[model samples]
Target: MLAQLTNVSLSFPDKKVLQDVSFTVYPGDRISLVGPNGAGKTSLFKILTGRLNPDAGAVSRAGGVRIGHLEQDLSDSASGHELTCMEAALEPFAGLIRLEKRLEEIAVKLGREGHASVLMEELGEAQRRFEDSGGYSFRARTEATLTGLGLPESLWDREVSGLSAGQRMRLALARILLEEHDLVLFDEPTNHLDVPAREWLEGHLKNSKVAYMVASHDRRFLDAVSEKVAHLDRANLSLYTGDYTAFRGQVERAEEEGWRRYEKSRKQERKLRRQAQDYRAWSEAGERAKRGAADKGFVSHRAAKVMKRSLVARRRMEEAAENARAEKPFEGDEIKIGFGPSRGRGLIRAEDLTIGYSPERPLAAGISFDLSAGERLAVTGPNGSGKTALLRTVLGEVQPLSGGAGVSPTARVGYFDQDHRLPARDVTALEILRGTGDETLARTVLGRMGVRRETVSKPASRLSSGERAKVLLTRLVLGDNDLLVLDEPTNHLDIETQDVLLGALEGFPGGVLFVSHDRHFVDALATKTLRLGIT
Candidate 1:
């Protein structure tokens, strides 16, 4: 086994994150870890990587196993602040890098006609080690990986700190792939990847010998790359030997069977309860008779014995009923999102609109679209294709470089930014939701979105990414606008929450416009699509 966790358990003071979770990862195992927003998938990854210790049980790993963890955070201190993109990508092969530099230095020395027999021998040994370590074409491998991950040669000389989050994530992924560890851990690795990049990564991983465990919400990625699905639900890790679709089917079947058995148990318990109640009534009547007959020279021994036996039987039946496990059926909660009444049609209209930061360099131009009342328009394109700029222009957050993009005078647009920049980080979720002027409604919306009651009072910035998403969505739902503009609405949400959001979007009466790369989400909600091209 590459790594194994046996009967692990972890809990905080207020919540039990994981309980008795066990799973084993073997060499070349491609496992996808899936769960709800607040499930302990990340915690499990930490445990596997030895970042956190389990409260109970043990984690074992094969000796000398090398693990590469691609975390969500791209600001890696180990890569150093001054390193260029190429240098950082090749950080794992520092030995080879040094060898290459030394060989160059020896070449310069030999060119000077110096008597350097020892230097020549040293150079020969370094060359042997370099060849043995697959260093003969390491630069080619690095370039190939970077290109495959969508980071081209033009980005190689740039400072790592200068790259955007998406670029940084790609570069980090490229670095990890080039490093070629025995096992790799990826947490939402597809978050910033475009469709092409995701496809490339899937193909690369499929052909690789490296074992990888990925925690991802992208169903397509999971289905494409996973050979096994590790579902983390209710603090238990259940392994299903198939892709995500197959695992989903298995879960559905199991849930149905569980409910069926639970119902059967409940029926048995009801029967026992009825019998117990009858015996209790008989015992009570016997007691009354015994008391009444006390003055009539005493009760019969048979009657007394019958009364005692009846009481004992009733007690046993009650015990059996209490011991039976008849859990309630599982009915998931859903967020209630209803847009307010629409004032008029043509909520948003863009005519030959050119949107960008500057007039000289428009990201896209000659774009025309109209969104009517109750219509859903999806804006899709590769990264940096003016999708977000178009949304901002329609929202009047940015001025159009040319042409015109206008919203109806009567329509009220509620915009959800992809970054989820809250108005104030210090404010609690309840406070933010209450910004809409209804505390009870705010709490209800939050609850329906699966935000815990206790967490509502915590600072919005302090919540998990998913919880923060729910908070933003709650605010949007409560806004009661005639038009809703959402940007990557499902970025951090789990599948269940995504489904709820999708249903809300479909049912919403107001006009909708969204910018997203999630094909599934777009397919489910978009009535019309606008495909933008790169400038």
Candidate 2:
């Protein structure tokens, strides 16, 4: 095993993140660690990476093991160290640098007059060592990793600090993959990657020799790369052998079996209790007989014995029922998201729309579509393909550089930005929900979304991403908007919550337009698709 966690537990002031979690990662093991938004997958990752010591139990690593963690914080990467992109990526192979220096030294020595033979021998030996140590291939490997991760060769010599946040994260991922680590921990590694980049990464990870554990909400990616799944739910880790789909099947079967056993035990207990009552009645009848018979002592003894046996049988049945009770299946919170009825037939229309900062360099052009009431339209394209720009154009958040876009005068458009940008004002969940002017309805919606009563009073800034998402959706749903425009709505939601949102979208009565990379989600809810930048 490369790393093993035994009975690991962690807790904070307010919540118990993990309890008695244990798992082992072997060489080349592909593990997908999954759970709800607050289910402690991140905490477990911290424990595995030694960033935080577990409150209880042990974490062991093989001797000389090297671990790489793709953390969310890109500020601490090579950019922070003031290194160029190429330099940072190739930094892992210091031996290659040393080998090159030695080769140069030998060349300088060979230039001298008398010691040609000796220098030649030394040069051959160094070259052999370099080749054996992968010195010759390191540069190619680094370049390939950078390119595969969507960082072009043009950016290789550029300063890392000049890159955007997403670019910096991609650079970090490239550098980590270039290094030879025994194991890697990836937390939401696909967050900034486009579809093509994500596909490239999936292929790269599948063929790599290093063990890895990824915590991602992308089910397709999980299904693609994971050989084993480690599900962290209710403070416990359940390891399953197989891909995500198989694990889901296993869980469903297990839940069904548990329910079946529980119901059977309940029925058996009920039958036994009824029989015990009948025995009690019979014993009472015997007591009555004893009161009327001449042999009162014998009759009383029989009645007492019968009563004791009946009580004992009932206790045994109750004990059996208690022992047979199964643990409640984990049914995560549901987020019912939908829109109010649209006012007009043509909710949105874009005619020859060109969206970009300038007309000279448009991200996408000639985009024309119309969304009618009760229709669902999906916008899809690669990164930088103007998907978001197009959506912004339709919503009037951004002016189209060419052509035109329009919404009906009577239609109320609800927009959800990809970055989760809510109102600038600091407010609690309750305050945001109160925008509907119905406190009871707001509370009911929040409760249905699984926002705790106590948490409703807390500031939105204090809530987790999932909680904030719920609050935002509640606001949108309660706003009674006729048309809903969502961008990557299921990005941070747990699987259960995603399902809930999907069901709601599938049944929504109004027009819907959304941008999402989740293929399954798109397939489930999209009635029409607009493919951008795919000519």
Candidate 3:
């Protein structure tokens, strides 16, 4: 075992976040930590890294283990554009390079067979070391990782500072893989990644020999990369052997089996209780018939003891039945979402659109596509395929360049960006509704989405990100535009929430366009996927 967490518990005052979380990280273990949002997954990682102390319990490291963490947003960590991904990866090889150069210089001036042999040996060792550091093959590996992460080759030369938050995160993930470490932890590793990037990461993780723990909301990614899953719930950690898919199956089966076991044991206990009840009733009748005043108290007391012992046994049996029962997650029966037919008539058109950051060198050009009403189009490609940009243009967030345009008016479009608009901001949720004249109806809508009445009246701005997203989604429905465009809508939502959103989209009759890394959501909701690739 590389690391073992024994009776690890954490709490903040009255709220116990984690309770007795015990697990082992072995040499080849790839574990995924999962739970409802705010279940203290991040807290656990902090505890592991010594950033946070557990309220109780202890985490012990076995041997001298090298632990590496891929920190959030690493673009600036590299600090310069002079170093490419390959160069950044090979920083360790700089020392080896210097040693080899000195040895070669000394060997050139001395001409002895022994010295030459020694030189050759050292040179060979250095070369091997460099190769192992991924020096000669570093370019290919870096390029593959970068490309796999949906970054354009052109980005290889771009300043790390120029990258967006998501881009920086991808670069960080790539670099983490480049390093050799005994154990690695990834927190929300797939947050800004695309489908292809996610798949590539999954493949790398599957073939990896190192121990890793990933905190992620992407079920497909978890299913692909993890060999074991850890669920944090009710202040307890439960480990399930196998990937997410296997875990889900196992859990479902366990619940079914639990119900059976509970029923079986419960029935047996009931039978015993009935028999005991009958015996007591007969004993009482005998006492009444024999009513010698002297026998009354003694007989009554003996029979009462018998009844008490039987009841105790019955109580213990019921407790055992309860212990045997399984509590499984309850996926909602359905989430109602309605979208009207898009006002976009026969055609949705982009004419000769040249899109990008600057007018001097636009990202993509001559982009034109028509998505008509009733067409569920999916924009897809590598990470930098300008998918989000295209959606924005469709929504008129970005104006078309010279000689380019989206013919449809902005009013006809509704967009849900990759960064979901709904973040619990400080504004009272009531204000959020009142601002849009949706106050009177807010409670009903929120209740439908699983928000309680008490929760609805509070400020949405004070809510968690997921809660805010829920509120914004309600607004999107209120917007009631014809065309629906979404960007990475599934980013932070858990498996169950993702399912609810999927059900909503699948039933939506309006023209829909959304970009997501989730293959399951894509397959279920998309009518036709548009291949958006950057040159």
Candidate 4:
């Protein structure tokens, strides 16, 4: 094993986050850590990366093993903030580049008559070091990695600090790969990647010789990239030597066994109950025989003693049956979610409109199109291709095509954006909801989405990300909206919550136009998809 975690336990004050969880990372372990929100997936990664200490247990690594982690981690502070993706990736070899330049400077200085020969010889040694480290070819390798991740050549020179979240994340991955550590840990590596870019990343990871562990809910991604799947369930961890599909099959089988055992136990308990009833009948018969003897004037001590002993025996049998019944188990299947009332108008019509930040790159031009209501369209294309821009345009937050756009006037819209910037941060949840008019009605709506009364009183900033999402979605639910435009809305939500949202949306009456890279979610929700691209 390249790394081993043994009997690890971690806690926060009164809460035990992880207990006796252990797993191994071998030389070729391409594992995915998957679980619902609050499952300690991120916390586990922090411990593995040494940012946090476990309350108990020890972690050991093979001698001389080198590990590299992706750029998204909070603990990874680099000295190249001023550099671009290409430059940042090549910064590790900056020392060699400096040495190369110094060697040249020394050579030039040595050309003077007074320069020492010893200095010139030292320059030769420096040159050798630079050459051996591939000093001259580092830039090419860095550019290649960036390009493979879908970062355009033009972006190679842009300041990293000026890049968007997606671009920055892509750069981070490039830096990790260029570092060439023996093991690489990717924490939510697909956060900002588009579908194709994500695919490219999977290809690179699969081809890499370095070992890695990726924590993600993307089943297709895990299947595409990993040879081993490490599952986190019920606070227990287990590893399977196969792709995600196979591992999922294994889990299903285990759950099936649980179901069978549960049923068997239930049946046994029922049988014991029946046996106890029969024993009661037998005891009553003994009493009846004693009563009959007494009525006939034959009530002897021996008869009475025999009746009492038989009753005692019956009671013992009943106790045994009760014990067996106590061992019976009660288990229920995972909840099944289904939506009602799926029928709706067939189109979300938009009139002639132009959309863009500048005329040079209008997201959509004279965009006259209509999506059948309930049609699931995926607005896609390269970075800055305007998928999100189109979403904003439809939501009326941004300028539309010169002629303007329309949503059939009667079409109500439900918008879910990544930033959730629709509301102010300082306002209490109740105030925001009441902004729709009717404070009492707002509270009733918030409750359905899992937001409590106290949370409604707190400012939006005080609420958790999930809670914030709940608030926005709750508003959408309460409103009589007919069109839902979500902008990477699934970014921070757990799979189960996503499924919950999916359940609510599956048969929703309105049209859904959301931007996302979650294939499973799209598959589950999108009845028809729209692809965005340049004409």
Candidate 5:
């Protein structure tokens, strides 16, 4: 086993994040960690890495095991890097490189000193150690990793400090893959990757020998790379065999069974209640007979005996009813999203549109499309292909480099930015929505989205990424928009919430123009597609 966590429990001041969670990581294990946002996935990673201690549990790992962790942010890896890309990629083999240099020195010494026996022995030992450490093929592996992650050969000698944000993220990933660890933990490693890069990563992970645990919201990616799924929900962890699709199927079956059991319990409770009522009526009749008896002793004794039996039967029935009652199964909060009535038929039109910040070097050009009421258009391409730029041009936030793009004047457009930034950092979600003049409605919407009452009062700056996304989505739902333009709308959403959003968009009557990296979502929602960056 690579590592094992037994009976772990963790909690914070306000909530219990994990309870009696236990799992083990074996060699060559490909596990996908899945859960809703704020479900303590990261905290579990921390505990495994020994960066955080569990409130209660025992954690064990094999001796001398090397573990590599790729966090979501690559800022630290990208900073203070003056080395070339190749050099940075090779940083993990510094010890091997030093041993290789010493072998060269030994050769030189042997040549100058007439091949001494001691020098020959030293050279042989160094050579064996270097070979054992994979020093001979580290460079080749590094180059292959860099290229597979979308970095070109031309950028291999370029300074790492000058790489773009996306390139830097790829570089960070390449470094981790080249580290040659026994196991690796990746947290949303595909966040900055385009579709092709994501596919490459999936293929690489599938063929790799190293064990890995990844936490990602990409359903396709999860289905591709995961061999076993570890699901964290409601402060408990459940392990499932097979890929994400199989895990989901198992979960659905379990939920259906739970509902069936609950319904059966309800039926039994109802029957018991009816029997109790009948017995109560019998007891009441016996009491009335005793009260009206004129023969005194004999009639009263018989009536009293009847009343006693009926009362005993009634009490037993009530006890049975109480035992049969079952609490309702938990069906998580529901999100209700609807678009208001549109005033025009045409929502957006773009003719031979060229979008980019620079006129001399356009990112994409010659794009033409028309969206009318109740139609959905998806914009798709690789990274740096100006998908966002096209959305901004349509929304009038950016000036088109050439051609024309316009939205119907009567249409009310609601925009969801990929970055999920709030209008004001200090304003609370409640305050932001209450500004729409219906505090009651705002509270209700927030509650339905599973935002805690305490969370609604907190400033937007303090909210988690998923919470911020929820708040932004709430604003769009309440905006009464006739035309919706969304960029990476499913970035931080869990699978369940993603389904909800997909259903809402499908049922919406207004026009939708969205750019997303999620292939499944795009396939299910788009009526037409616009492909950009085609050479």
Candidate 6:
């Protein structure tokens, strides 16, 4: 085994995050880690990397095993470094680079001191090490990895500090891929990737020999790369065989079977209870007959015997009822989203719209679309194709460089930003939604969205991405908006929650305009699609 976690248990001050979670990573294993928001997936990853200690249990790994972890944050990766993208990508091969330099120095010495036996032996060994370490082809591999992740050759020569957040994330991923560790742990690696980049990553992971366990919300990506799934829910871990789609099928079947067993138990319990009640009544009648018997010895003795038999039967039935009882199956909280009545038929209109930060250099131009009530429009394109800029322009948050984009005066808009930025770091989710002046209703909505009571009271900054998304969605739910503007709405949502949100959006009376790269989500929800091209 590459690594193993046994009977791991973890908890925070307010909640128990994981309980008795055991998992193992074997050589060439391709596993997908899946769970709801705030389900301790990150904590488990940290534990595997030896960055966090579990409250209880043991973690073991093979001696000298190298593990690579790709985290969500890349703010400190290339910090204080002016290294170019290529330099950063090649950083993992520092040893090989040094070997190459030493080989050149050895060659120089050999030229000066011809026929030196010791020097000749050293050169041969160095060359062999370099070749075995893949020194000769490291550069080629680095370039391919960087390019495959959507970092063009043009950006490779640029300084790492100059790259955008998404670019930097891709660069970090490229570095990890090049490291070629025994096992790799990825946490939402596709958050910044476009469709093509995600596909490339899927192919790379599928063909790689290294073992990996990835936690991602992208259904299509999981289906493409996973061989098995590790699901964390209700503070427990369960393993399912096969890809994500297969895992889902298994879970559904298990739930169905669980409910079936529960119903059968309930039926048995009811039957036993009725039988027990009838036996008790019969025993009581026999006792009364014995008490009122006129024929002395025989009648009283017979009644006494009858009462004892009935009492025994009653006890057996009562015991059977107790043994047959079954508790109801547990169900997690679900997101309940519904828009208020819409007032406008025409929600948004964009005509030949040119959008960008500066008029001289527009990201995209000549875009036109009309969004009406009850319609859902999806915006799709590669990264940097102005999908977000178009959404902002339609919402009047940014000025259009040319042409026009307008929202109806009667339209009440609710927006879900891709970053999920709350009003303030210190503000609690409850405080944010209490603006509606219905605290009870606000709490209800938050609970329905799977935001626990304790979680709702915590500061927004402490909430996980999924929790924050649900909180923002709760705010939207409490509003009376006629149009919803969602950016990457499914970014951090689990598959089950995504399905709930999809159903809610489908039932919504208002119009929806969203920018997303999730193929499954777009395919299910989009009534009209606008494809933007790079400028």
Query: Which predicted model would earn the best lDDT?
Result: 6
After superposition, the stretches of candidate 2 with alpha carbons farther than 4 Å from their true spots are 78-81, 108-115, 286-302, 324-327, 332-340, 436-453, 464-466
How close to the true structure is residue 202 of candidate 2, measured as C-alpha lDDT?
Answer: 96
Higher-scoring candidate on lDDT, 2 or 3: 2
Please identify model 5 stretches exceeding 4 Å from their true place. 73-80, 106-128, 154-167, 290-298, 333-338, 435-441, 448-450
Ranked candidates, highest TM-score first: 6, 2, 5, 1, 4, 3
For every model shown, what is its TM-score relative to the native structure? 0.89, 0.91, 0.76, 0.82, 0.90, 0.92
Give the Cα lDDT of each candidate. Answer: 0.85, 0.82, 0.71, 0.72, 0.87, 0.88
Ranking by lDDT: 6, 5, 1, 2, 4, 3
In model 2, which range of ten residues has the least summed lDDT?
331-340
Worst 10 residues of 6 by lDDT: 332-341
Residues 1-535, model 3: lDDT tens digits: 8888899888886568988788888888999998766678888887877778888888888777878776543633553556664455445346655655665665664555555666677767766776675556755766787788766677776766667778777777787786778999998888788777788889988888999999888888888888899988768899999999998898889777877766776676666566656655665555554454455777666656665665566566556545544444344344344455565464467777777766875667777677766777877877666887777776667876644556356435566665556544566665666554545565555555545466666775567666666666666655566677777777657676676667666665567778877787788778888777666
lDDT of 2 by residue, 1-535 (tens): 9899998889998888889877899998999998877788878877887888998999999999999888876745653547888988888887789889999888887787556787888999999999998888889988888888778888888887787788889988987898779999998898878777889899999998899999988888899999999998878899999988899999999989888877786777677667666766765675576566656677667766776676677567656656655555555454444345557788988999889977778898888899988899999877778888888888888899989998888888788886676674479889887877678777866765656789999987788776888888767767877788998887777676677677766767778899988777888889999988733
Candidate 2 residue 293 Cα shift, in angstroms, is 5.8
- lDDT string for model 4 (1-535, tens) is 8878899988787456788988878887778777666667877877777767888999888888887766445335463568766677677777876887798788778887456878867877887788788877887877777887778888878888887767777877777777857778887888777787778888888888888998876767878998887776556778787888898788778777777776776677677667666766765676777677775556545556666766676677667655654332333223322223434575466667677888776765656667766676766565666778787777667876486555556666678887776478898877767645556656654554445567888988888876888778756655566677878767766655575567667656667787778877777777767666654
Residue pairs that clash (backbone atoms under 3 angstroms), model 1: none
Q: Which stretches of candidate 3 lie over 4 Å from their true place?
A: 73-87, 92-94, 100-144, 150-153, 259-375, 401-413, 419-426, 433-467, 477-481
TM-score of 6: 0.92
Off by over 4 Å in 6: 75-80, 106-125, 333-340, 419-428, 434-444, 459-466
